[model samples]
Target: MNAPLLEVQQVSRSFGDVRALDGVSLTIAENEFFALLGPSGCGKTTLLRSIAGFEHPDGGAVLLGGSDLLALPPNKRPVNLMFQSYALFPHLSVAANIGYGLKREKLPKAEIAQRVDEVLETVGLTAMAKRRPAQLSGGQRQRVALARAIVKRPRLLLLDEPLSALDRKVRAEMQLELKRLQHEVGITFVVVTHDQEEAMSMADRIAVLAGGRVQQVATPLELYRNPANLFVADFIGTSNLLPGPSAGQHLVVRPEDVRLVAPGAGRLDGTVADTQFQGGTSTVAVDVPGQAKPFLVTEHGATEAVRGTPVGLAWQHEVAVGEGLA
Candidate 1:
């Protein structure tokens, strides 16, 4: 493989005595949609800001396109950051705001206008170029901010929870728009978000971070199916973390992976404890005879199980165990 477009080597950051990032390192390929996913205060945003030149790392170097980025100022680096709030100038029109970066470079009026028009078209904001930020809806304002960032044609774009402020429907719509925009522009996009659903839906590869360290980096499906550790298994989706011995390590299995069989058909026997119906699927909690807590089982098209019903549970060995890598 060719050298990565962005290389973060042993990056570490601290605030007095507290460590925000601890010896974090990762590489990002050109034109890839990468996501830094973690819970709040896990240092995902700190890592993004470090890459964007907003926060200076005390320990390691950030390299972009084979060049050290530490020596360059934020404005000189080939990166643009789109903040969560959209950060649009309230007084400026959409077109003027999109053209702000180009104008600051001392480019000629014709060139700035030309580039602004092109980006407006790219982001589907040409029709509302004259409208101020307040005149547009949430989605339109987000597009304008995106156009402004991309107008400079930076080599990399950093997004910090860009869709978190929007409603669920709009957020889903913007996810597709962001993906389409990335393909059309063909630039590297690194988004930092705590929402697992957002990362799973949009990222080509996701780096799961926890407690200021990276836990696992893999495609969404791979991370969901084959997690490297217990944190990843529980974080990526809903899973039943059973304290059963396997290969000298504790095991965890997703609710869907635990299959309910006829009585005396499986190794574990349980009594149904509770049930929750969620549209097409239902979840049933079973109290295993030897276990202290109830285990959850997710079944589709079968919601008839009631509390106190005897049942057998079994799961495949592969889904029950994950290699212990924390």
Candidate 2:
């Protein structure tokens, strides 16, 4: 949204017969927490590696501040990449792990120590500075990896599935922490993740990729509410695709948008085939006639409806997202 900090223009890459990236372009603002979100083999990682200069693209340009980033060697680039693996040296202390990059740079030891101390405090790991990677929990280990990456004060940081190692609860907590650290560190973060919720909850903006191409780029709310096409609608969240009023089009409705009504009272009636209680809310799947998949509707609190109960699906408005947007 602001002046572009990183510009990827018409980038294309191929691994033998497979086109890993095809004409992918994006502009990321400075200090923005951007996410490259897609399923496996979608080329998000390839694009990231291209930006980091680890995997050179077959064509096109990667620019940082309007200069060619692909010109620089990987070690010479002013960017850091944190792999999914923590990559902390088992024998090294947390402080040492964070300071290793500075050590490689041949900076004065005192400066490295001061920076490490400051980062340790910022990441809330000052108390565990002396602990080895083996001694830390999964979350703490992830913090150590992040600390190591950021200690260099790189212009940008690339994370590859940074939360994949943690359990669900810790993953949620670290998502908050990662966003906090991104703001405090003031470094542009570009994370690659297949988990849609992780991207939606943590990123400032998301770029959804499929078949090695970008499907859409927007804020999480925009992507959920106004998906550019069918792939995005199905990928970003669950959707009920009812045949549209016009041919070759469909009306999209989310579970939260659909209302459950008495049999034959609304637009479509069906049998309640399944009910799922997920804590505060419940999901009721109705098997509508002429529909291959069950239509899902959300009900607040708990669902008391039993299987085989007759129900109807209702919604106030019908929208065709766009003509041939798919």
Candidate 3:
């Protein structure tokens, strides 16, 4: 990672006895794509708002390039938040929408036009520059919002579920588009999202939050392979969390790590209960004798195993999960 560009230290907040953020601390690198990922009511949005100057944290500090960002108001802060709504003016043209911020600062009309034109090309909306928001598709509108935000050349870009409004196909396309735009703009991105796939696919690193606290912060691959604790194991990706022999301990098993063999050859005896065939992979659920929940196994390509087939379940390795990791 590059040198830290944004520092959030022990930030705390409350909503009349409901502690929203509890001593959250994070260091975001310059030009890195960082995600604040969590389920609803986990305070990720609050954290984003705090950084954007929309919500003042009850405690701790926010620093940008070693300067006090908390002291500045929302408009004065060197950051821009691209809301999920893509709040573009219905009556304004694409060029006008992108140039609005420059107009607010009273920049020269020629300069505004130049910047707007640059970003219009950057977002691939040059041909639609004269079109209104209603005249654009959902993805194009999203680009307009992004272009508007980046045209200001803010130091940081905060996005709150920026792709939530689009359909699945467009959302997937926009995910790559967002990464491209981030790299082209060369700005630090702090995206708050509840979608696990979105965070995993786009973010260079992700801070998984839950219950108003950070569960773990790691790259998507690292987080998936080695979760810090039980909560993280249960949250980041799909895991078959089996209770351990002792209390406060659990086994974290990924479906891919599970293998099936003839009965009595592996550790546990079970029958294939169900199979879900995805394009290139088949997920097999096994009903073990003593286990309350079926163990899920992922098999590449089409699996020949069908329901009622007897098999033994074995693990590639054992990962002992404890409660004290946090």
Best by TM-score: 2
Candidates in descending TM-score order: 2, 3, 1
Ranking by lDDT: 2, 3, 1
- lDDT scores in order: 0.89, 0.92, 0.92
lDDT tens digits by residue: candidate 2, 1-326 = 77789999999999999999999999999999999999999999999999998899999999998999999999998899999998899999999999999999899999999999999999999999999999999999999999999999999999999999999999999999999999999999999999999999999999999988999999999998889887898888788887766677777788887888888778899999999999999999999889999999888989887899998788767443433434
- My TM-score estimates for the predictions, one after another, are 0.92, 0.97, 0.96
How high a TM-score does candidate 2 get? 0.97
TM-score of 1: 0.92
User: Which tens-of-lDDT digit does each residue in 208-263 have in candidate 3?
Assistant: 99989988899998888778888888887777767675776777788888888889
Worst 10 residues of 1 by lDDT: 241-250
Candidate 2 shows a clash count of 0
Q: List the residue pairs that clash in candidate 1.
A: none
